[model samples]
Target: MNMTPAPKAVVVGAGPVGCLSAIALAKLGWDVVVYERRPDIRADSLQASSCEIPARIPRPRSINLTLSARGIAAVQSIDSTLVERLLYNAVPLQGRMVHHLKGNPTPQQYDRQGHCLYSIERGLVNLIILETAAAVKNISIKFSHKAVGVDFKNNVLRLCNSVTGQEFDENFDLCIGADGSNSIIRHFLMRATQMEYSQHYLSHEYVEIRLQAGKNSSGDTFLLDSDHLHVWPRGNFTVVAMPNKDKTFTCALFAPREMFDNLQYPDALIPFFQAHFPDLLSLLGEKRLLSAFQNNPRSQLITVKANLYHKGSVLVIGDGAHSFVPFFGQGLNCALEDVRILSALLCEEKGGCDPSAIHRVFKHYSESRHEDLIAIGDLAMDSHLKMRRSVATWSYTIRAYIDNLLYALSESLFVVKLSQTIFGPESTGWIPLYSMVSFRPDISYSAAKKKAEHQKRLVDSVGISLAILGLGYILHAFINLNKLL
Candidate 1:
């Protein structure tokens, strides 16, 4: 009897998505190799540099990740034990605590079923995923190795050592470009195939502010609800915060570059904070707030979308394939889902280095992923308006209540009745757009967007019917349809 050889795979970039891809491939009996240009993300980028104010701040990567249903499901799909390890020290956010300028904060639960999101540092998640990938038997990680070029037809990557500057070539049965937003693999694919691509930088810039956890008068340690995500959404400009295990809140302010430039003077920041975030100002303290605004790095947000994700045996995943603004907090989740989807698709193929079979796999992956990726990109970019303006409106509040009520009555209690009445005979059940996009991994992004539009129509028609017939007029029927979407 002859033993079959394992399929070979090379994953570029050792970020969370790349690591997860390597692990998933290895699990399918693939001999996987992961290449990273950096020494070690933990030491090189994930950890703080001499310039950063906080010792724990990740240098190159600033924004923390909000892990929702899609990300959780993907991790669970990869390894059950891995999910436990990742979520052990994470902060669970049950809902958004919306802070208004002149009134009390409003708390909105994510779902009645106690659904929540986990907030973890970008560095920590990347580190954990890399470590988990390293533990896999057939996966190997190559640090300080940069992929400079690629040969799509032959499935080869031209590599250069970061420290030594020596160049070499390596070919694999399958090569995945998990190299982030500025992926070399995507570049090579664009040259080989006319891969549609677009990237834009928003005028908005963001600055991270560290809010130290407090101590009450009794000297007992206290915090601003570690279980809730804090937000001061002020229309075009906003401030958002997520809790850390160390009891600190990682707060970020998003404003136009002009605003940031105007407030460059030390004196301007406090006054701006007082006017825009007076309630939060008291908690942030004068000293820390001043220092954070002055010293913390301000960064720009970019959004990218590409078509034709694969050509030949090469494929791009994560930010390399589709990059979104952080507004909806789906960038990382979608990327992780990419790995899960790719892995599952690969598992369908027979364990052999069949070139034609692999090409077909790549073709299927790109065609299937296109619409879903485009849907997410649009949603993530537009969600900023919904978060900043609509959340505080009476219309938004009423819509939330109605959505939940309809979901319960239709989905939980009367799925058949709903299908006949409001949703046509084809309707499955009511799902709030938020629930569909963030909490339902089974539903693709494109499907969720389509269903959301249909739901909107039904809500409007019903509300109008009640009013015209002199039944109770639903004045609180949602109005910001464009922004809310």
Candidate 2:
């Protein structure tokens, strides 16, 4: 009797997204191996490499994030325990605390009722996902192994271990690239098939700075608000802070590249920080500020767009497929959801699918996800403008007011329901891109936009009705007073 072999999956990159992808696939009974270009992230300690940060300098580790309900729901779907563990260490950001031009009466909150995002250290989050993947018996990890290139047509991969100049060829039935923006796997797959791709780097450059904690007499921590994301928005640039598990904060100065490049030395950095972000200088201190400016790397923000993310046995997800600017704070969240969607699709196919099935599913994913990814990417870019300028605009304020009203009405007023009920969560699941991409399983990005559009229209209709009713009431009161006269 002859026995068939289990289909194998090769995942490139051992980052949070990659690790999660491997674990998700393993859960579906696929033989999986994950490869990382760098040494083990679990063993390495990097300081505020990602955008998330804490409140106070020489501070302990903290991360800046907007862990919304969408992201939370996605993580919970796969591993509720993991979500619990994350929440146990997570800091809820009820809303963004927008610091107005100095001496403003009050700060702005993102949501009136206090529904905020979250702040979670990138390092710790990656560690948890990696650890979870390690626990899965069917998943294997190869650290310090970099993919030099790949032959997508042959389903073969060439990898080099950094420590040793050892090279090897591995054949797999499928390859999933989570290798980040500059994905070698993606480049290889594109060569074998017709793939459309575009990448754009924004004019912005981000510099991460430390804000040391102030100790109380009891050796406790003393600082400003610890429960909110603090943003001091300047016209052209901004300084933002996110709280850490510890008693400190990580602050970042995001400015145009030209501005950063013009200031070449540590001393120049001090003056720049003082001029643009006065309070941060006092918090970070001159010495530490200089060190961070001169020593630490300046992060560049970019948007990567790919037409098709898969071909034959090779596929791409996460940063490899769609990496947007950090303004939206959706990169990690979206990447996590990508795995959930991919896993659900592959699981639906079951064991009977051929090698091309995975590739075909990915093709569908790219097409369906393209609009949402583009929309979010565009939204992220637009948000940078909104954060800096539109927060005070009349149009923005009216939009915000209408948005809140609709959300409240949807939850409160049951008499008139939204159109979503007709489509339902499954049929219209494609419509709530946020719900589908970030919350539900197998729904594409484009579908979510359609749902959101429909929801927006409903909100608009209600708003118009309210406006007209107010006008009628005012006119009626005037006529009654005239009759009395």
Candidate 3:
């Protein structure tokens, strides 16, 4: 009896999302091939070894990512051991340490029940995923292989080997574009079909600065609190820092492009830092800040969205499908979630590697996942405004307090039973918007957004009623006082 061969899958890009995709497909018995434009990060001698703690290397620009419940759950689905390895060198961030110009920093916890985020190096996590992919059977990783073109009609990808300067074409049963914001596969799919694509660039640009580990009077390495994510919100812009395993902090200064343009030289940066970020200047030192400002690259922020994610046998996931700002720290987590959802959907196929069934799977995925992807994209963009300004405001803090209070009350057994008896099963549980998005994996993004909208309306109504009652009481007291007089 002739047995059917395993279906082949070609995944473009070798980032975390790409590597995860390869691992997922390989586990499903698919012959997987990964192509990356850049050389293998694992082969780089300067990169930290798998067993060693990673050190912060000075890069022109870097964006630190936080792994919360979503990312953790996705990795756990793949392999529990992988999650352990990824978090081996990560720092736990229990809350945000809001830095003020003239006062002590304030701490704002992420969740009420002690849920936290893990701060890890982006490159280190990528390398770990790469190593995991390397160990999986039936997976081939081709480095320095740049995908130049795609033939949607034939399911073939054109490539160029950077080292040998040779071009080739390869065909696959299915093609995945885990390639990032500037996805070449996405570009080809747009021309082949009616893919509604939109790209928006924010006015802000960010630059990265590394703060060396400081020593205490007793000679122990100490700087800012390692357990908190430090934020220096300055109304219009912000500087945020995350701890590293090497006792240093990786800080990124996000500001308007015009502000960056004005600070063209080292001389201008000194006064600018001293004027706005006096405390940060003292921590990083004036000389180091000046050097970073003058030397580091200023990277632009852009959000990319597409209405359709798949065409025929090709599909796009991760940043390629929905690229958003980093304020919410959901970009990487969402990408990993994509892999988990897609893999699960593929595993449900009845006929096993049926092309028509695979196409149906893709259609179902695009239709079901589009709204959630768009919802998270919008949330991430809106979060940028909150982080840079509203985070430091009293009104925002009060609103957060109310939100968390309601969520906590709803979670109590007494309240849950009372709500169910009084209202219905549907109203038995309540969760804050942030908790729904970051903590609850079972809750879909679109459902979370809708629930949050309903909660906001209810909260607003209660607030208005309370305000009116208080005003009426004050008015009545004043009238009684006048009558007594």
Candidate 4:
């Protein structure tokens, strides 16, 4: 009896998501080929001088990533060792430190139990995943190979070699597109199928800045509290800083394009920073701030939403399928989760490496993951407003307080028994929306969204009821005082 050969999977774009997908496929005994448009970042880092600062510093183009539970869970699912390696150099951000112009900064913890986000340099994490893929025996990584087009009917991907300037085609049993927001595979899928797609660019753009590592009055290496993500929310725009393992911070200034364009000349940045981010100016020196303003590239924020991630043998994941703004810091987390979900679905198939079962797996993945992708994308976009403005408001604070309070109370012995008796054994219990979305991998994104919406309505109703009762009490007191008079 003859056995069928192992299935082959061609992955475009060797970013974090693509590399994770390749690793997943390789672990399942499939031959995986990953094509990256740029040179291997690991090789570049190795060749650079030891004294040279990583691309993350001095230059104002780095985007720091916040790795939360979703991303951590997904990576752990692949291999817990991978999670350990990726987070070895990461800084733990316990909460957001909201900076104020007139007062001292206030810290807002993400969870009641002190669970926090891991702040890692984006490029570093990508390099780690790519290197991990390179070590897998069944996975082959081809660098400087740009994917230009695809032939869905023939199951062939067209690529151009950046080094040799030669065009070639590779056929595969499966093609996964993790090429990011401007994915070439996604473009092909749009033409091949009736896939609905939409993209929205936020008016706000961002520029990166670095806060140098130095000792404070306390003699600590970190200038700011390394345990928290620092934010200066100015309503229309916000400046955020994340700590690095080296004690320095990668700060990003997110503002309207008009605001950035107005400060085209370096001199204009002084007044702008003085007015909006007065406290930040002393930290990011006037000279460095002005230089970054004049020289750094301003990148646009965009959200991409697409339906039917898979068509025929081709499938799109990560930013290729859905891209979100960075406000919620869920873009990378959601992308990694995509890999975890897809891998599980594929593994459950009876014929693991059979080409015939590929479509079934793809279809199931597309159907199962679409809603969650859209939910997280919308949540990320909405979070920009909340982070920059609502976070400073009393209403937002009270609601969050109530949400957290309910979650804490729900865990108490008395409340748990009472809730169980009142709502019965089927009760899901109380969980804050942020906790559900960030900490609980068991809760699906769509389910979390629904639960949050329901919780919001309940909170609103109770608030209104209390306000009315307070008003009635005041009126009754005034009437009684008048009668006594």
Best by TM-score: 3
Number of colliding residue pairs in each model:
0, 24, 0, 0
Q: Indicate the residue-level lDDT of 239 in model 3.
A: 95
Task: Write candidate 3's Cα lDDT for 284-312 as tens digits.
Answer: 99778878877878888999999789988
Indicate the residue-level lDDT of 25 in model 2: 78
lDDT of 2 by residue, 1-485 (tens): 99776778899998878988887777777789999988765543323222222232222232265566556656766666767666655677665666665554234545544555677777667766777788788999999998987876788989998899899988898788999889888888678777888899888878777676778787857365777777777878887788766766777778899988876686677777777666667777888888877766888888898878787777888888888877657788778777766765676667314766776777776676667677777767867777676664567667766666654555321131211111113342112223333333333355555566787787679779999999999999999999999
Residue 394 of model 3, lDDT score:
89
Model 3 stretches astray by more than 4 angstroms: 1-3, 43-51, 54-60, 216-220, 350-352, 412-428
lDDT of 1 by residue, 18-58 (tens): 99888888877889999998786553332211222223534
Prediction RMSDs, each to the true structure: 7.6, 6.0, 4.3, 4.8
**Candidate 4 local Cα displacement, residue 197, angstroms:** 0.5
How does residue 430 of candidate 2 score in lDDT?
16
Per-candidate Cα lDDT values, in order, are 0.81, 0.70, 0.83, 0.83
User: Over all chains combined, what TM-score does candidate 3 have?
Assistant: 0.93
Error of 4 at 203 (Å): 0.7
Deviation from native of the Cα of residue 146 in model 1, angstroms = 1.1
lDDT of 2: 0.70
Better of 1 and 2 by TM-score: 1
Q: If scored against the real structure, what TM-score would every candidate get?
A: 0.89, 0.82, 0.93, 0.92
Q: Which 10-residue window in model 4 sums to the lowest lDDT?
A: 415-424
